[model samples]
Target: MVTVAPTYHVPVLLRQSVDGLNIQPNGTYVDVTFGGGGHSREILSRLGENGQLYSFDQDGDAERNMPPGDGRFTFVRSNFRYLTNWMRYYGVTAIDGLMADLGVSSHHFDDEARGFSFRFEAPLDMRMNSRAGMTAADVVNRYDEERLARIFYLYGEMKNSRRLAAAIVKGRADRPLTTVAHLTELVQPLIGRDRQKKDLAKVFQALRIEVNHEMDALEEMLQAAVRALRPGGRLVVLTYHSLEDRMVKNFMRSGNAEGKTQQDFFGNRLVPLKPVNNKVIIPDEEEQTANPRSRSAKLRIAQKLG
Candidate 1:
C-alpha cells in the first residue's frame, strides 16, 4: 500500500488577515476557511476568556491541526458555503468578526494523489472533500466540448480556451485523460512553448475551481458573512484571484446593487459597510520571497456600518 503523507496546509496572509479582523477581546469570530488552523490559532490568541472562535474546514485532514480542546474554540469539518447555517447550529446568532481565506491549501496541492498541482504525476482527483463529488478526471473525460471550453474560458481565463477544449476532446478520443502528466502532455502542443506552463496552470486552476464550485461557494459565503455579522463587525477576506478580489471589493465599496453608494435624494450616506482601505493590501517583497504563494494574494477589509 502506498502511504500518503499527512496533508499540511499553509495558511496564506496570516498576520495581515488576523490583524485586519480587529478582533475585540471578548467578541465572537469565525474563520471560514480554517485550512491549517494558522489564522484560527492567531484569532484564539487575541480572544479573551469570554470570546469564542468558530472555525470551518471541509477537508477532514484539517481536523488533525486543531488545537487542544478549549471551551472558547470550536472547529467544524464542513465547507464555509454553509457558514451561516453551521454558525446557527452552534447557537451563534451574530459575530463580531469573520475571515475567509479562499482557494486550495498547499496541503491539497502537495498531495500528489489529490491532483491539485501540475508538478505531481497523480490521478486527476481534485476534490477538497474526497467523498463528496466528481473528480477532475470526470470533468476532463466526461464534460462535453462546449462545456469544457466554457470552463477553461471562464474559470481559467485561457485565451485559447476553444482550441484547448478541442485538443482535449481529440486527445481523449482513444482513451480518457486520467492523470496530470497525461493531460499536460495532451494539451502542451495546443499552447505555445513560451506560455505552455502558464496556460496549463490556468487550465488546472479552472478544473479545480469547477470541481469544488469555489466561486459559487465564495459568493454564498460572502453573503452569509454580511448577514451573520453584528453592527460594527468586520469582514476580512484574502483572495488569490481577481474574481474573488473583485467580489470582495465591490461588496465592500457599494454594499448594494448598481455598485452605487447608498444615498437619498439629498445624497446622504447609507452604505452597509465602509472600506477599511481603498486599495487592496499585498504581501511585501520579503514575505513573497519567503513564501512564493503570497505573491498573488490580495487582502481587503470592511467594517459593517449601522
Candidate 2:
C-alpha cells in the first residue's frame, strides 16, 4: 500500500484497449490487472457517478497506485483467477466489460530487486504475487532435469532445452544457484554471445511461467470471464507472449481452452464468446517506438453471446 513517486506501470495500447470495451456511462466494468491505474482512471472518467469499477491486482505495488478517493472505484487485492468469487462477494453477478493486460508489468522489470530482468544481478525471485508461491530460484535449484527440460521446451520454446536443463542440474550440484548472476553464468556459455539476451529472456520466461502457474490461472480466469459477464459484455485482453496470445485466441474463438467448438442439435456452434475482430490487433509503429516493451503485444476482443 506504499505509494512511490516513480510511475508504477505504463499501460500498453491504452486507447485501443479501453475503446474496445465499448463503454456505457452507467455500466459496470472490471480491470483485472490494475497495474498503474491508467486504464482504471480512464474508465472512471467515462463512468457516470453511479457507474462501478472493480480493479483487481495481486501485487502489493499495484495497490500503491490506486486512484485516490474515488468512491466509484473498488480495489480488490486478489488474483483475477477468483473473479467469480470476488464478484459474488461484491454483490455483482454481471459486468459490462472486463480488460486484462497480461504478462509482466513494467515495474517488475525496472526494479532490479524483483529479478524479472537479466540486466541486473539480484535474487532469482520472480513471483508476481511475492507474498505467496515458489520463486524462480526454487525452480532452478530444485526441479529435476526432465521437468526443467519440459518447461524450457514447452514454455520457452527453446530448441536446446535438454542441454540447458542438464547444464542447470550440473551447475546447481556444485553450488546452489540463488541469484540472477549465478543462473546467467551457468547458462550463458550454452547460448552464445550473438543471441545472449534473446535466449536468456526465453529461459527466464519459462521459469516465470512455471513459478506463477500462469497458463493454469489464465484458463481458469477465462472460463470465469465467460460466466461473469452479462450477455453481450466485452472481454478485452492484451497478451505480450505468443503462448498467452495463442491461448486467448483459442478461448475467444471456441469458448474452451482446447479450442474445440461444441455443436448443438441444429449443428450451430455453442460458444460462450464470439470474437469481435477477424484478426488480432497490434500496436501501431508510433506506440512501438515510444514504448519498446509493447512491441510484442497482441490484443484480442470478444463478447459473451449467451
Candidate 3:
C-alpha cells in the first residue's frame, strides 16, 4: 500500500490504476485529477530524468501537496476540462498517457465548511474549484422544480426525484434553502428511514454534479484527452459514479460519449482506441476493507490507436 496522508485522501486502486498507464520512462504524462498527489508521486517515481509530468487541479488546496524542486514536474492550476488548451499553451503537442481519478477527494467531504457531505451543517458550497463557479445552494434554491427534478432523476438515479424536487420547492417558498441541514431536512421525510443515507447521498451527488458541471466537463475533457494523446498513448480513468462511468466506457469504445460505432464496408469497427479491460475493474475485498469509500470505484483504461 502506498503511504498517503489519511486525512487528505486515500487513493483507490492506486497500484492498479497506475500500472494500467504502462508508464514510459521518457514519455510525457498528465495526471488531471491530482487530489492528494498519491498517484502523481508514484508516476513521478517511475519517470526518468528526461520525462515530464503535468498535474492539474483547479483547487488551490491541492497545490500545497506538490513536491518541491522537482525539475520534471509542472503543476497546472486549472480545471482538467481545458486539458488540450493548457497542453498546447505549454507547447506539448502530444502526451504518452493521462490518468484521471474522478472521485471527489476525502478531504473535500471531511472539510465541514465545504458542504460536500450531509453529515455536516455547513453552507451548500460544493464547488471543486472554490475560486469560481456557482455553489450548490445556487442550484437547489434557484433552479425550477422541473429542472431540479431532472438533475436528481438523471444524475442521482432517484426514483422519487419528482417528489423530492416538489418538497424542496415548497420548503424553500417561505425561506431560501441555504445549508446542508436545510436541504436534507426538506427531503428526508420523502425517503424511508431504511434508505435515508443512500437516498440523501443521491441528492447530494446530483447537486454536486450540477454545481460542478461535472458531466459536461467530463465529456469535454475526455474528448480533449483523445485529441491530445499520441498514437499508442493510454487513457486511464477511475470513476466513482455510474453517470460518469457510462460516459467513460462509451468513449473508450466509440471515441464519443454516445457509444456509437462506425464501420467500413468490411464491417470493421472504426474507433480511436481499444479498451484495455473487457469488464470494468473494481476494488477487491482487501482494498474495500482498507478503504470503504473505494467500494464504488470502477476503473477503465484504453489506448489511443495508430
Please, what is the whole-model Cα lDDT of each candidate in the order they appear? 0.86, 0.91, 0.92
Expressed as tens digits, the lDDT of each residue in 1-306 for candidate 2 is 213234976678888898999999889999999998888888888888899999999999998888778789999999899999999999997899999999998888889999999999999999999999999999998899999999999999999999999999999999999999999998998998899999999999999999989999999999998998999899999999989988999999998887899999999998898899869899999989998878999999999896
Task: Summarize candidate 1's per-residue lDDT along 107-141 as a digit string, tens digits.
Answer: 78778878998899999999998879999999999
Q: Native-vs-model 3 lDDT?
A: 0.92
Report the alpha-carbon TM-score of model 1 versus the true structure.
0.93
lDDT of 3 by residue, 1-306 (tens): 323543478889988998999999999999999988989988988899999999999999998888778899999999899998999999999999999999699899899999999999999999999998899999988999999999999999999999999999999998999999999899989999999899999999999999999999999999999999999999999999889999999999998999999998999999999999979999999999998889999999999999
Q: Indicate the TM-score of model 2.
A: 0.97
Worst window of 10 by summed lDDT in candidate 1: 1-10
Of the candidates numbered 2 and 3, which has the greater lDDT value? 3
What's the C-alpha lDDT at position 227 in model 2?
90
- Candidate with best lDDT: 3
